[model samples]
Target: LEKAGIEIDRKVLADIASADPTAFKAIADKARAALA
Candidate 1:
């Protein structure tokens, strides 16, 4: 998040972390894109 200059809510992150594999992968990809 710091690297991307982005901040996500803790609850949102927790939800993402607990999401299904596909959902988690999508969110992770978005984060990577932000960093890129």
Candidate 2:
């Protein structure tokens, strides 16, 4: 997100992501697409 000029709490995001890896990948892909 930083590369995309988006600011978010990495630690908080990491915590939330660790809860569900599958969801994390999906969300990550979406974020990448949006950033792209």
Candidate 3:
């Protein structure tokens, strides 16, 4: 996220993600796809 100028701690992000896996995975997949 820092690469995109967003500042979020990894663990904090993980905790948030764990709270809503379906939503997080969709967005996370898109973000990872961007790297590809």
lDDT of 2 by residue, 1-36 (tens): 665454658886697688878866776776797777
Tens digit of lDDT per residue, candidate 1, span 1-36? Answer: 656554777688778778766776776787799878
Per-model C-alpha lDDT, please?
0.73, 0.71, 0.70
Consecutive 10-residue window with the lowest summed lDDT within model 1: 1-10
Per residue, candidate 3 scores C-alpha lDDT tens digits across 1-36 of 555444568887788698988867776776676667
Q: List candidate 3 stretches off by more than 4 Å.
A: 1-7
Candidate number that wins on TM-score, 1 or 2 = 1
Best-to-worst order by lDDT is 1, 2, 3
TM-score against truth, every candidate: 0.51, 0.50, 0.50
Q: Measure candidate 3: CA RMSD.
A: 2.3
